[model samples]
Structure formats: C-alpha cells, structure tokens
Target chain A: MDAIDCDVHCAPDSYEALFPHLSEYWRQYITEAGIRVNGLAHAYPRGVGATAPSTYEALADRVLDRRGVRFVILNCLTGFETHRNAYFGAAVASAINDWVREEFLARDEGLRASLVVSTISPEDAVAEIERVGEDRRFVQVLLPVRSDLPWGHKNNHAVFAAARERGLQVALHAWGRAGKAPTPSGFTTTYLEDYVGNQSIAQGQVLSFVSEGVFERFPDLRVVLIECGFAWLPPLLWRFDKDWKGVWREVPWLGRRPSEYVREHFRATTAPAHLPRDPVLLDQLLEMLDGPGMLTYASDYPHEHGDGLAGLLDRLGEEQRRSVMWSTAAELYGLAGNPAASSRA
Target chain B: MSHVEVRSGGAPVTKRGVELVDCDVHAQATEPMLAQYLSAPARRLLERYGRRTPRVTEWYPRARNAGMRVDAWPGKPGHIWGSDPELMRAQLLDEFGIDYAVLEVLSGQDCYDHPDFAAEWNHAINQWQLEEWLSFDPRLRGTIAVPHEYPALAVAEIERRAGDERFVAVLLPASAAEQLGSPKYWPIYEAAAAYGRPVAFHTGGYVDHRGPGYPSYYLEYHVGNGIVMQSQLASMVAGGMFEAVPGLRVVLTECGVAWAAALQWSLDAAWELMRDDHPRLERRPSEYIREHVWFTTQPIEEPDDPKQLVWAIEQAGIGERLLFATDYPHWDFDSPKQALPRVMDASLRRAILCENALELYGLPRERAVP
Candidate 1:
C-alpha cells in the first residue's frame, strides 16, 4: 500500500539560503535593517531535545525512506509569520516556497509541498497561490494556525477560494509568531503555556469555519488541522453538534449538522498522537472521531518526540491503520494515483 | 451563623455520612444594591449610561425561565431563578437536602470592562453575599468576586475577605480579557494562595473575547462555556501559575469534566516533546492539573455509553478531582442522585458529592447526616 505522509516540516537554515529567491529590495531592506533570520520566536530553541533533525537529507532518509513513505507533503516552518508588513510577509513566503521547491521537492521524486502564503493580506495570499499553486507537487496551501481572525470568517474566504480554485487543500499548521497568545486570551508567561493552548486555537478555528458556513460558501475546500492533538476533537464536535441544533438559524447557510460538515470538510494529521494511558480509551476516542476516514499520517519530521507512524500503526486496527497510514491523506490530497505511486510499487 | 427555615425538596445526599455540599448555587442582588456599592463616578456613569456591559449581540435568547429550570422561576415578575434567596433555598438546598451551597452570583456586571466598575461590582456583589445571603443562611458559603483585570484591586479584595472563612473561594469569570494563567492575573492567584483560598472560575461574564467568537444564540454560548474553561485551564497549566503559586487550588465550576481528561492526555503528550519550552515545570502538566485543579460536575458530559462517562472521569483522575454541582436554578441542573452513573462506587460517589469538595475548600466534614 502506498503511504502518504501528510505533514513534514522543511525549515530553511537562514535568510541567506532564500536570498536568491528574494527580490533585491527585500534583500537590501533585511540587510540594512539587520533583521535576524525568520525574526520569529521559536518555542523550542535550536540544538535542544525538542528541535527536529534539521537537514533535508536526514529528514528524507530517517522519515520518508525509513518509513516507506510513497509521498510526503513538505510543510516549511519559517519566520513568514514575522511579516505583519504585507510586502515583507509575501516576500518571505514566496522565498520560502521557492527555497523548498528547489532545495527539497526537486531532489526527491516522492516529495510534495504546501504552497506557503502570507495571510496578512488575503489578496497577497491569493496572488501567491495563483503564482505557485499550479505546481503539481504543491498539494495544499499552508497557513499558520494563529490568524488574526478565525480562518472561517469571510475575511479568509479569498485564500480558501484561491486554494479551491487551484484544486488544493488548505492545511493549518502550527507556526507563526502569534501577535497575541495562541489562545483567545492574552499572552502567557511561558512557551509551554502557548504550546498546550494551541489546541484551543485549532478547535476554535474549526468551530469558526463550521459556524461561519465556510463549507457552504466553498464546498470543495478541505481543511487539514496539523499538530493539534485529535483526542479533543470528538468532544468539541459533539458539543458543536449539540449547540448547532439550536443556533442553525444564526448561520442559515449551514445546511447540515456542524459535525457532519466537519466529517465532510476536515482532515486531521496525527503527529503528537496523544495516547491516554488506557489504550482502550484511545480506541474509543478514535471511534468517536470516526477516525478511519478523518486521520492522516504525519511525522512532523525532525520534531523530536511525536508518536511515530510505526507506534500509531501498532495501536490502530487494520482498517484504521490503512486510513491513518495513507489512504485518507492520499484521497484528501488528491494523490490516489500519481507518478509517485510507482515508486512504492 | 444565622438560622434559616428548612424547606423540602432539598438536594439529597445518597451516601450515608455524606452531608451534600452543592458546589455551584448562585446568589444575586438587585440593581439598586449594586448601585450603592459603586463609586460616585461609576454610579453617575451607571445612571447616565444605563448599566453598560459589553455584549456581542443585543439579544441573547434563553428558554422560558431564561434558561433556568421551568419550575425554578420565583413567580415574581421582576425576579430570575437565583435572585430570590427564598426560592433558591427551597428549590436547591432544602429540596435537594444540601448541607451547604457555595454561592456564584451572575449579575452580568462581573465582566465589566472598566476597571473601576468591575472592581466595584465585584466588591458590591461580595458584600451583598455577606449581608443578604450568608447572613440569611448559614448553609450558604460565599465567594469573593474579584475583578480579574485589576489584579492589585482583586488581590486587595482577596486580602480583605481572607479573614472570613465563610468566603471559601475567589470567583473569577470563566471568560476574561486575559486567560486565568496569564501572569497579569497572577496577583489574584498569589493572594488566594497566601490566604489558602481556592480560585473558583465560574462560566459566563467572559463575553468580550470568547474562544470561538460571539455566538448567535444562548445555547451556543452555554455549550461553548466549557471550551472557554478548557482554554483557561490550559493557560493556568501552561503559564506555570501552579508553579508560581504552589498552594493555589483552581476549581473549574461550570466547565464540564471530560475535556479535562483530554487535556491531561494532550498536555502530557505535548510536554513529553516540548518540555524544554517550559523549563520551570518540574513535573508533567497533567500532574499539576491533578494536584491543583478540581472540576465541577454540572454540565457533566453525557457520553452515549454510561460506562464512558465513568471511564472519562476516572481517566481524567476526576474521581478524586470531580465536585458535584447542581448548577441550581439553571436550565441544565443535574439532580445529584441521577446525574452520576448507578454503578459508581459508593466511595467515589461520596467523594464527588461531598468529601472531595469539603477537603478542597477546607470545610470541616460533618460525618453524620444532618
């Protein structure tokens, strides 16, 4: 069976690496301003235990090659979120996309990437999508999980519209130096606080998308929530389903149950697979989430300490394993059958 | 302590020697009482502006009784369910056989945006609890409603109220401008810790910045309350508030139980990989939650399987952490006898209904049935 690794981060070492891809104006501005690379605070410091193995060769060999991944979607985590300035964000995103394309995807036949877009301006995001989205290797449009507004709000419709127009999935990955705390609440004192709080943001974004009628607005758009643990999803959806019954009129555009739309329009990548001590509870949780069809395999490559694909496969039933390991992602990313399929064969 | 007339239909205590303590019974004061406590400027502004509280929408629909039990209405044209002390006692404490009921007042003024108003309203409400409610009923324990945005003022209130053991906890709105874990709110935590008072975070009053955004209806707002609580819990755990104030205990009043289980698992998972991000955390995040946090059993998550509920409670370590709450006079009040599974252990039932809460609040146990 061909396996599709849905989430794998390919971070650039420095701005110098993307200097060729960046326009002269940005290069000069960055140099003159003495702006450090990525200009964003990393929750995990480099050379620390949490830092993923950095080299592209190491990622390919350790994750894709070792795991027998037929295809892998590269999600580049750079300081693109530092670009509150529209021009700067767009330039950083463009350079990162170009850097990933040339330095990684081109070299690996099995590699694919999410077209990174600076969402400071939907117009810029759409334009960037229009520019780089046509590339067949780019399977999705990557936006950081921390956005100014819920991604479902109409303000974000342009990015989703552009992605759907290009036959691309929109993936929300964890990165971006959030202007406020990752949660609705203001800043926390520590990085751990922000990290655990990411789940709330992911859950809120999903609720925002469903409640705001994002699916009804664009039926073709699919959202993949990456790095957010999936155990909390069942409860959130259950609550949304219960609440939507009474408030459906508020969002009259939503024609079905919130959970129904969730099952239809959303895909989740398994990285930090939060396994409860009781394995039975984990099984029941997945059953509640309708996991066979919703979960996708992801290593969060080089990020030290995620539930590896092998560990997850061991826990799931055969049917669930198949879906989580490859099929669900392949079907979602629209890679059911492609040239890469032959590599596994 | 003052004496009160005992009424029937008191919330029952199923286990013998377990005197029932309702974790979340509300007490409310009329508008005139609130006006008296306000500063001259606030009172003048209140009269002129007609009590401005930030709301996302003009209308918030509630079922008959305004999302209170259909029968809980005081029958007075002007009164909501918990506003009438007599009605609250008869409907919640007497009928349910509750030995004690902690009061959580929801006046819509708790989350007042202006620092002066929020502080004054909280002070007034806490005062109202003292004069009108606690003085009227010894069975009733009061909470100091602290204005979370102004930590200095909030800490001062906690300091003032610390002498009164009747005031068992400090109540902060579930929804706040800053999450409970943010260092900005730590002064309140510090005060509570110094005084050995648990911080009770009750749902509502946090409409300004809801986790998902403002809702169209009250049902969404009501169910979404737990989501807000979850975020606050994460903030507290991740923000290292527990580390900063080691003696502090957080009681999640209106938030449901199951999410804590999920958070425990998820936090532990995240910590395993990202422990370096928070070097101050001496132990796993879940360990901090287990030791420092207590969740109320109102809006208890009703999973399809009866066993799943127990499984979740046990999985979250809430068997020890869960506090039985009726959310009395509200729409979804859980009758203690029926709220939990029939198969629950007698010890566990007693712990949730009476013992755990008594221990956390440092209330002396009344081992004999009253």
Candidate 2:
C-alpha cells in the first residue's frame, strides 16, 4: 500500500522567506507587480504550500503514513511569486529552489521536488536548472502554462534543450495566470478553458513540444502533466494528430506523428478529479491512457481537495496502488538510483 | 431489455459526410422588410426625440448575404455562410452530405418594424429558414425565430408558421425582453406549447459581452464568453418560464455541463425555500427544469475528461435531451467523428447527436442527411 504523490503544489511564505534576503533588483519586481493571490491559492496558509520539509512529514503522517505512502513528488508553486517585468522571475526561482532544498527535501527521504522555472525568460530558466541540476532532490523542471502561443516556437527551444540536457522531466502545471481562450459559447469552456489557469495553453504546450520533435531530438527526455484533469487530454491528442497531418510536412523536424510522440514520451496524472473516488471508472480511465503505468496518484492534501487518506484509498488496490504510491515514480524519477530507499532514516 | 450499447449496437457510432446540426446558426433579414416589423410610430417618435434608429448594418455586414460556397471561401471562415443560405446548405448538407442541420436567424432579433411586419418577418424567416433548409441544403431544418421583445407578435408568428411544420422550435434568449417570467411574455410560450414547439435558449449577450480580465488570446475568449448562458438559465428559472408555460421544453446552449447541474440544484433549492412565491408552479423547480431543459454540449471541450459528459447528463437528468454539437465555423469546432468519447454508448450518441434534438424540434429524421 505504499504511495507517492507525483503532483503536489508547494510554495513559500513572504517572498523573503525563500531568499531570506534578496538583492535590491529582485525586490523591486515583486513590489511593482501589485500581485494579490487569492486566499487558498496554494496548499498552506502560513507558508508557501509546502516550503517546509515538515510539510512532507505531515502529509506522510496524515495521508501516506496511514495509507503506507513511501514517497511524494513535490511540484513547488513559488513560481506564483510573480513580477510585471521579467528580470526577477529567475532570481525568485533560484532562491526558492535553495529554500526547497534546505526546507522540504533537507530531511524528507520520500520527497522529490520539481524545481520551478520562471516564464519570464529562457536564459534565466536554464541557468536556474543548471544551478540545481546535480541534486537528486530535484527530478522535474516545472513550468507554468500561461500563454496562448504554442510551446514549440523556436524561442522556447532553449528551455526544452536545458530540460533535455539535465535529464529532467518537463512537467507543466497551470498557475493561476493563464490568458483566456476564445469561445463564443462563453460558459467557462470545459476542457482547456474550464480551469482558472489556462489548461488550453498546457495542451498547446504539450502539442507544441512534441510536434516540434523535442522528444524525437532527445529520446531519454520525458514530459509530464501535473494536476491536469484527464478529460481534455484525449480529444487534444486526437486534434494534435489530426491537425499535424497537413502541417507537419512544413515543420519537418518532427520524425513521427504527434500522438506517437506523446505515447512514447508523455505521462499525465488524475489529480483533482471531478468525480469522487470511483475505483471501477478510474481503472477504465488508466487503461484508456495506456494503463496504470502512465499514471501516478497525488492527493493534493491538506486542502479538502486531495480528500486526504480516504480519497487516495479510493483508487488503490492491494498491489496496483502500491506502484503509483512509490515504485513507478521510483522508476520515473530514477529513484531506484538512490540509496535513500534503503536508508533507515 | 437491451444491454445498452452492446444490446443496441445498431445505432451509428460515427457519421459519414457533414452529419451536423449547426445548432446555433442565424439568418438575418434583408433591408426594409425586416425594419417593417418594428413600431414605426415608436421609430418616428424616437427619431423625433433624436434616439438613433437602430440600423441592421450595425450587427451585420452586407457581405454575409452574398452567396458564396463554403469550401471556396478563403481567409477567415466568417463569410462561409454567405448570402445564399441555399449555397451553405448545398455545401454543408447536400455537398458534404450533412443529414440535417438546424438554421436560425443570424440577425433581426430585436425591435420589430410593426406587429404585422413582426408577424410577417417571423413567418417569412421561419418559412425562409425552412425553405433554406429544404432546398439544395437537403440537410437543413427550420428553427423559427420569435420576437422575444413582443410576445403577441411572437405568438402570432409561431401560429402563422405552425402549419408548415418545418419550424422545429421557437428560438428565444432565455432572458430576452427583460421581462421573461412576467405575464407579458407568457403568450409566446403558451403558443409554442400548443404547437408542440420546444424553446431553444442560446446564451445571447443581448447586454454585456466582456471576457475574463486576462483573456490574452483566442483560447481565453472561448472560455470567457460561455458564462452568459448561466445567466440566461437563471433568469429563465427565476422567472418561472418553465412552470408558467408547462410542456414548453427548453434547451440551454453554450453553457458547459457542470454549471447546468448546479443551476438545476440551485433552482430546486430556491423553489423549496420560496414555494409561496411561485403559487402557480405545480412541482419543484428542478423537476420542471430537468423535464424541460435540454442542454447542447457544443463547442464541447474536454471530450477526453472522463466525467464531463456523464456529469452533464447527471446534472440535467436529461440523458435523452443532451445533444452533441460541434459549434462549426468557430475557433474550437469539435468534429463529432473524433469528439465522441469512447465510453459514450452508441444509443446515447445517436440520441444526443440527433434524436433528442430532432424529437424536441420536430425535425424530419428521413431528410436528416441523405
């Protein structure tokens, strides 16, 4: 019954807590944006959602400990700490990773953090990944899905290259900053536009990266969608395949069908599922997605959303649940490479 | 007696040709004929007082009426359905082999020229809308447009076209004329019920139309505009439109499935709390709504999201009434061929894609596409 949460949001308190103290330049960006995050934006109230290692200990004690959760993959949300000008995004990311290392992963053997990347600039994002690239504590490089543009645009290749070079997973999460999608019906579009952050951009990003042959160029590189609802993925994949037929001849870099690229490279999670725990249905969904192999469970805990231990148990069987709980993620993050699984502490 | 999809495998899982119902297509009037329906005395008085006489040009460009073929039109697809609707039908229906699609008025919805002209415009559009459907666009069907602002005009218009039988349903914004539940608008609903016409309510921003604060691109606009349908549903229920006009079926378009369920629950909850307010209502609000309110899951995004369709059906409690739509010629057009979820049983597909809509609108099934 061991469990692992591949998709979890962790943030920090006042921007200063992560950096402790920042240079004059970074502080100016935060002040100028006039950003006011709504209450309940992240996992915790007093701290960035999971800035403290104790956050993992608490989650283990509350959810995994009882459910036998052995590890939890952490996707930090400090990317939310934004600025109007692009300069500070990288600085904030660098400082936040340092804090995540010192706090959440400092002692929690079960913790695997996805280092946050600033959308503000490509060079800064690459540098931050390089700075923390050597640590086993970080497995994926997180990017917020926020714009209307496709992710394959050559301007983004630098970021994609950095991710490939570092052997890090490119995981896309929607922070609450995506621009709107055009829909005349205007009833809060279900899939791409349904959520607060742009799910459309996330789909577009996934499509862009694959269609551009990011995966084909770097075969070992893997991509994941965290906290992305399951419903939008299938149709979008179909669309990706359908649209690429006439167009990919123009974008010659791609060696295979976009859907084929996704099947070979991509993974998605069933977090924040709209339906309450329905095991029979969830199994069918996993099968459709290519099997339980493609999915790993993450109960966005503390918030009622993750629904704590009960909801996690909803989808688990004696053995299958155990894989998502720890083993599969163990394989994905190259966790088997770590001696930590054997560590008594 | 059936094993659902397996037991009833005869239904079509996919359609050939352009088998569609552009559920919300509109047809506008040509020149003075449309204006002739409005109140001329009111027009003169308003003009005398310096109120701008509303012009048709404001909402429509003359180019829309120009007859152009669908595949032939280049650039933006906005002009695809040009002046000759018969051409649109020929291309989309007869040419592409669309079984049948419903055609509504694209414009001329507001301020009729005179009651008689309103009656005639309503009659002619319904007639033209039907003829347009019946012509080369063999796949087309009529969706009668009503003068939502004037109920008597709407009733007279519905009655006049009632004989043709091509008029599928009476088209009205759930919240048109600002006084929907009031007694003033009951006549039209009554006429629709008498004639077995269902009421189709598409989310019309007859008022405000702005996107969410950060809609930076085309994607954002698609999600932001669909919210108005909720307001339409709310006003329709709060106004007691369903109860006031029993047997008057309603279809809520553009609003996504999740909200419709919420509205159904909220309306029922309100009915319980304020039963005295609606003495005329025979049953709970949700009961009437679930019975009467059908929803079009068109421009349907999140087709892969496993529960989206199921949740919508559960919420409306109208599995038979949830119709499939592509919102063709829009940024997020869903090709029904690819959009139908794998789990959607074959019967549900046929029922949602055409049967329910056809039954509600009284569309001819034989002439749907062939």
Best by TM-score: 1
All models, DockQ values?
A: 0.37, 0.03
Write model 1 residue lDDT over B79-100, tens digit each, in one string.
6667788888787777877887
User: Model 2 over residues B212-314: C-alpha lDDT tens digits?
Assistant: 2222222222233344454444445555677667678877665455445434433453354445544666676567667777877765534335565554455
CAPRI tier of model 1: acceptable
Q: How accurate locally is residue A58 in candidate 1, as Cα lDDT from 0 to 100? A: 69
Q: Candidate 2: RMSD over Cα atoms?
A: 10.7
Find the candidate with the highest DockQ and give its number. Answer: 1
DockQ of 1: 0.37
Report lDDT (CA) for all predictions: 0.75, 0.55
Q: Compared to the true structure, candidate 2 yields what TM-score?
A: 0.61
Q: lDDT per residue, candidate 2, A65-101, as tens digits?
A: 5445556677666664454345666776777788778
lDDT of 2 at B274: 43
Rate residue A310 of model 2 by lDDT. 50
Alpha-carbon TM-score of each model against the true structure: 0.86, 0.61
Model 2 residue B82 CA deviation in Å: 6.1
* Candidate 1 per-residue lDDT over residues A1-345, each given as its tens digit: 567777776676667778999889999988898776542445445522333324667676677766467888888777445557888998988998888888887888788888988877889899999999888788888877777666777878888888888788888876565555556565666665566666776777787788778898888788998877677776776566655654566667878887889889888887767767566776666666656578887877666545544555666777777878777877777675564552210
